[model samples]
Target: MNYEKRGGGSRSLPARVGRRLWVTAATALVLTAAVYTLSVRTVTGQRWENAVLAGRRQDETLAAARDANHMLDHVTVSSLGAAVAMLMLIGLARRRPALTAVAVGTVGIPLLLAEVLKRYVLSRPELVDAPARLSGNSFPSGHTTIAMSVLFGLALVVPYRLRGIAVGVCALWAISVGAYTVAAGWHRPSDTIGADLLVLAVACALAGLLARTGRVRPATERPSPLSALFLAPLCLVTLGGLGGGSLLLLESVVRLSPADPAVPRLAYAGGHALAAGASAAVTVVLLASLHRIDLDDPAASP
Candidate 1:
């Protein structure tokens, strides 16, 4: 059933959309601040040495993982462009004008923001004193931001009934891309985390815009119990990933050895991968909730 109610009910659509926007904005701001603190203050001074060693170890680990590196090598701008073009094509073929809008907004805006922040807004402090020779600003990882934006955009445009699977696949894609960048030494764990938050903020803002403009679809059938069941395991996996990653990070930091940095470095990179996986899982869960709102109305029948 289509709902055109604007202000008649206390649980109106606008109010709910507004609430979501506020929460997203607040979370994004807090995360951005935390990232800045880590980049500028926490990782400098005595901790700089450890951070550099960990990064080099991550690079070494990636060098050993030939298969993983080879797979990630194929994820270039040209290929991603083609994938994005195909996503747009799917939206157009579906004849859903809103899908096209959502796709463009979700992918385009975050990409632009990622570039601007890396270039001008956020600065990568000289925290790593190693001879590893850092090239670009590494506040928010550009590769990660691009990968996640595309994944989230694709999930947003797909059919609601298919969204659960879409989210799962996209989460895996995000995890792989995130891990690849970390292992390649293109980014640190913090960079990946920042990029995730930036993309999420853009998506949330776009969703609020759509909801406010009355572009959201009407109430549909209630969500299936199986849908909820499907997401539970993913959430647990995310929790496991985060826990494992955090433990390794702690071990790496506490057991930092300048002479034999290999073990610590391995732990750091492995932890980063697990952290990335956890971040992906969280993103999937957030998007799934939004999909539920789009497809399932609690007030409606199953």
Candidate 2:
């Protein structure tokens, strides 16, 4: 009976991990391909270009309060390198070697891929109706990728008790960066969306790999401290989405064209905001779901 119990229980863990790895890899590949196609092809269309252009030019209507470009300017390669180094230090301080490795792969692979895609794999096509559009490729916004990856990575290494708060903060940070890029004209909505999807795919793949390797096996655990803190951000995201969507609908009803300028720009900016909120919600959900699986928390919601 002892021998039978030992063999069966030992094999089950690997079998489960193998299944999760296969599923995660397949899903990630499909999502990455789909986002790549949309970003590279569909978003270059006149409609999308005009909407994005309007959003990018919203500051023109508002005149001078703040320079949106400031955010993108500071998110340079050097800044990202420093941020990564800081994150590594934090992970080491916690003495979680395996979790730190997972965090690095989750963030590092996506960062590398974002740069590669931006520099080589993708290109922004010329816009016919939107002749004033900015020149250069911007399929995957590097800033958004960096922000999201950092947040996601940090969430993975944080203690189980603090995971919920980390997830919430990460979601807010990612959304802010993504929205800022769209408003600053550094990237179109599709670029930021694609960046989020890409980061998510890489994070999931890395998580699955770690699980399969038995390097970061999930252990049954207590619920995180202040789990309710996570709910507030998710609620805020929902409200923001609803408000933005309503504004968009009103703009459409009023027949505000890109030619008129101000109203359309307002609508476009609202759309960008909505996208940010949606992306945040998705990120939060993903983190929560993964946390439940990783910690073996039976009380976690779907």
Candidate 3:
């Protein structure tokens, strides 16, 4: 129970948690701002984003669009409500009311923030001559936020032993949702990336709150090595492959004129890769942060 001695450090748990929270929040803010600036505030950024949208040729992305739409269709308000309720039920079943509240905040706060930003705070100027539909403000995709928030909520509420498995499963789904938004043309890659960053910031803030409340504790049980062995490689591969691939594709098209027929197709593929990679990266970071912290405080539980 002596956390101070266990970590081989003089700083308390709250201090450590506070430091992480600040670092994560600052990083998220900077990244979010960068995404908005590059993708919405500049002509080149607009051209690139618009190219991705235009590149969604029916012959190329039809199957992807179909699958993406099918996945996105389940992100209605009712479905999200039910998902939140299910996460709460899991927390209650584990006898962690405080954790349950944190889980709810983790899911709800980001969605609310995304809505406000998209509707009022953020704007997409006519940086380039693009279709009205493509120019509308959708900086942060609501569907992506919902997917990530649900993933974070579930990660918080699940048992420590099963945390790895739960996160692995849910992270895949969340990554898919982000990529799908791009493929379906419902959102730009920036929107999904922004949503991922927003959810990550909120998640870190909520985790710090839990630490301040003394709701976080050291896990009594040892985590399985299988999760580390499996998830580490999976995350690394996904992050490296997709992120690298996206960069390569974008780089290849950078010198090409926008009028080139290949630009749109390459941009669209790059955007899809970027969206999925960003989601996976965020999910991996969240899981790493929660590695040894137990959300349930047994002493505080009934």
User: What's the CA RMSD for each of the models?
Assistant: 4.6, 5.5, 2.3
* Least well predicted 10-residue stretch by lDDT in candidate 3: 8-17
Q: What Cα-based lDDT does every candidate model obtain? A: 0.64, 0.64, 0.81
> Please, what are the lDDT tens digits per residue for candidate 1 over residues 97-205?
6656777788888888888887897775655464544534676777788778887787667667666666666666677787667666666667777777787777777
| Candidate 3 error regions (>4 Å) | 8-11, 58-61, 300-302
Backbone clashes under 3 angstroms, per model: 0, 0, 0
User: For every model shown, what is its TM-score relative to the native structure?
Assistant: 0.80, 0.78, 0.92
Query: Model 2, range 46-151, lDDT digits (tens) per residue?
Result: 3544555565565454432144566667777787888678768867887656667778777789888988988887766654445554555777778888888887
Q: Residue 43's C-alpha lDDT in candidate 1?
A: 51
Candidate 1, which ten residues in sequence have the lowest lDDT sum?
293-302
Indicate the TM-score of model 1: 0.80
Model 2: lDDT equals 0.64
Q: Residue 80 of model 3: what lDDT?
A: 92
Tens digits of per-residue lDDT for model 3 on 224-295? 776776577548746774777577556735744656777787777788778888888888778777767777
